[model samples]
Target chain A: MIRMNKFIKLAIATCIIFSHSSNLYARDKLDIKGFLTIAGYHSSNDNLGFQPHLSSSDVGYKGDDEYLTLSKVGLQLNYQLSTQFELVGQIVAQKEVVVDNSDRIKIATLNYSPTSSLLFRIGRFAPRTYLLSDSRLIGYSNNEVIPNHDFYAQLPLSYVNGADLTYNFGLSDGVGTASIFTGRTEVNINATDGNTLNSKFKNLLGFNLEYQTNNWLYRFGYTQSQLANSWEQVDTAIQFLTLVSQDYPSPLVSWTEGKEFVEAYRVKDKWFRYKTLAVQYDNSIWRVRAEIGDLAADSSNIPKNKNAYVSFSRTFDQFTPFLTLSAIKTSSPRTFSKPDEGLVQFLSAQSNQNLAFGLQQVFQFAETSAYNQKSISLGVRYDFALRQDIKLQFERKHVEAIGSNLWVVKDFSKIKDEYVSLIMFSYDRVF
Target chain B: MNIRILIGLICFVFSSVASAEILVIVNKNNPISSMSKQEIIYIYTGRLMAFSNGEQAQPIDLYDGSQEKATFYKITTGKRLSQINSYWAKLSFTGRLKPPLALETQQAAVEYVVNNANAIAYIDEKYLTDDVKVVFRLDS
Candidate 1:
């Protein structure tokens, strides 16, 4: 693995030049250092609205007003490396929203503290989602709108391969401290066959558990995989929803001489199962949050998805004003079908008469993943202190989507009703 | 008890010996006497890592964004920078612990804790002058 990641980057540059000046003249050295937060946001769709090639996407987006690219970039390097041991990192350059985004540099692991309550980490991390993906990019961590126990928006959100184990026990001011965890991930996938679109490969599995205090937090997770939606790198959107459900063009029999039709398809051993319930209410002001979730899938069943979101925040003196209402309900949620015997029955007879003329022209043009979607976000943040370590933030998001992402060629089931706006600026530093 | 009660007790012991600047820091040979602003905000917010006489106190911070860290964390942990940034983003995503080791003043944190030993810090009582000792007095 690139020579053990270059010997863990030369043992983290010899433990940051032997613990930054040898603990200023070691006397039983316990030296430590911190800071690093690079951020960026400009959503129109591509995570936080699903369409990063939809694995039954999340972020209830339907796409419309778009512009303002590279929504993420990151870096958070820490070193204590002793007093038991510590060497954490979060680097990003964009692998897909929130890892350490500003332009991106997503996670660069190497932690093993052995006791403060025990901890261990390996490479490329960010899989402890829920409670806002576990402190989602720390930018003063939370004011809410998106952090209702996110199981990576539904699962398998960040990984290049992983491992994590953390434990903290018995302590309280009001039930706080008694955390537990377990993790494992094995990744590598590629997809294309939505019905013979081509390309395929699948292998993924994930797990999680968490509990926090000094305010409140809890979580549980599970992830499984059989993917190949071209292993998402950017939307092709289920190959544009099977080219609008096989672009119709058939009339009665002789459908390319019967036989067995096929254009693209792949599901095999596919599975997605998830469950979560989250909460947060840290002190020193007013900030509350809530989350609910449930999901189930088998060979192919797009009917059993659930989501929820809630937020409220107010803090001035480094500004923080927020309000959010989010939702997602795609019941019977498991899609990607093709098998009545395939070979090529005239492209499934011009693709089921073009998905029955795009599912009976649903109310006329507007959906593409249409189910039960919703959005209500209003924000404003200004956390400036630019230098003392560095931090300068700016935010503005105004969005509204009731239903979107499901347009079987304007035979709409949803899509249309968006008034999006975004402006996320930041400058975070930590060395 | 005459002559206007001895001129209000000589203006209350001359303004209590002129603005009573109580500076009694310890560990310059340990003799402990005064300390309370909630035990110096629980030894500078490592969440009371001991020392109300239980010893084990080594808290120090300044380089995590400064104005002497909003005036030494608002006169010692009254906290507000979004509650010390949501308590350090939940003590660093629940790995649990971190936030300290920032030196720049208070005479380099009392010469880096009067040269270690359960190291603790504080200064600017007119820079203490004779190498350490002022326990606590952050008001405002």
Candidate 2:
């Protein structure tokens, strides 16, 4: 990890030095551009914990204070060494829902395009999970303040450290693109118990196929990865279980045994797969788009979910009004790990019945991580000036936990099977 | 009073007919005589960066905030200026596909297209001359 950090710093420093030198000497070969999105939102229910996306922490809305968690600023630099080689870097500063503020390099890549049809990129690149994955953070490029959270939130990794190859072919009157990419990524998960889980995704392999005509686009993508569990999170769970089981009078399960059980059932390395299909038709006046995604993990601890959304918008002069309906459903079977019958019987014989109950609660908490939600959003985007836009959006979301409450915050008792409203305003521009 | 009204109506009709039309133009040396609306849309939007003959093509645009430029895009691509800018923002920041080169005026765009056989541009019909060939025209 230390070596990787040093290498990243060196790469960033090199890019910055090259960019400056090129600007001073080869000015015509360097280009600089940037984007900004300033946004604020208010939720109707003060106690409602709203997570902007799956990767984000829940922002608690209380009292009359609106949240500016969605605001972002980014700058990109492109330096062309020749017709076929270029170096590109982008940095972004934003306020995260969990972490207060973060500034990091979003993408730093060296590109080689030998011909218009074939291109190769190395270094860190955004994971091509969806149609807008490449530009998902740039609000100026999207009609909505953000992409549909129901579909986009399921993506855990944002970028990968590796390479990708893209080939474009002209088919009749349309253009088709085929891309294959592989990489590895590490994600930091802030667990509810104030512990951070370091999840590592390895052997990432993905492919995307897209076809675009003058007015229509169709895309299909698939990705599969293996996740190595975080030992810190597993140890925390095991320690908590051991403390609960200490009251038992019989042979108490050792911490190592508890760790082994948790790893076998929940924390071990698991295969994760994601698939998506999307289509869009935009004729400058009327725009319609639809996307469906499926996310699955082989382990029962991780819930397999399906998400889909459809949106329609019409442009009238400078104003565009749009409507979207999105839904997510978890199909994982609601079955708790049964306390080993022999252990339960032995505990009963020893009159340590409470230990058996404690064991069941652990499995029940694991089931609560699955989500079931649906939302409808209405928004209007007005181009008030050149290269600038203002958007107002309202979303009414309904969340239900068939088995357990996944969307709720620390206190699940406050809300369940209820509707919440979110009102958002954003100013986006490109400079 | 009737005579004055008739004269006013006649003037309005004449002015409407005199309104400028946008013409897509290329160098006369280029072999392509004409292009379809879809083809022009693709070229201007950066989807097709090359001509049918596999030669690199550069599309030139009038300076930002120009009414003629706005009208040309609205008529040819069915998109307002702001939408087009938004579209280009995504492509530019992600794929490094820069928008068309914007000149100071329609005259400069015409001059650019006239000089470079690989360049294509749009200008008012009145600007058409022997130096450039009009491949497609959109009436105002």
Q: What overall lDDT goes with each candidate model?
A: 0.45, 0.73
Best model per lDDT: 2
Candidate 2 lDDT score relative to the true structure:
0.73
Predicted model with the maximum TM-score: 2
Residue by residue across A144-172, what tens digits does model 2's lDDT show?
88778677765646577888998877788
Q: Which ten contiguous residues of candidate 1 chain A have the minimum total lDDT?
A: A188-197
- On the 0 to 100 scale, the lDDT of residue A143 in model 1 is 46
TM-scores of all predicted structures: 0.32, 0.83
What stretches of model 1 exceed 4 Å from their correct place?
A: A1-84, A87-124, A127-134, A137-140, A148-320, A323-375, A378-431, B1-71, B75-82, B85-87, B94-97, B101-112, B117-120, B123-140
Off by over 4 Å in 2: A1-28, A64-66, A97-103, A190-196, A228-231, A235-268, A334-337, A341-358, A402-408, A413-415, B1-19, B27-31, B114-117, B125-133
In model 2, what lDDT does residue A76 have? 82
Residue A381, candidate 1: Cα error in Å is 13
Q: Chain B TM per candidate, please?
A: 0.29, 0.88
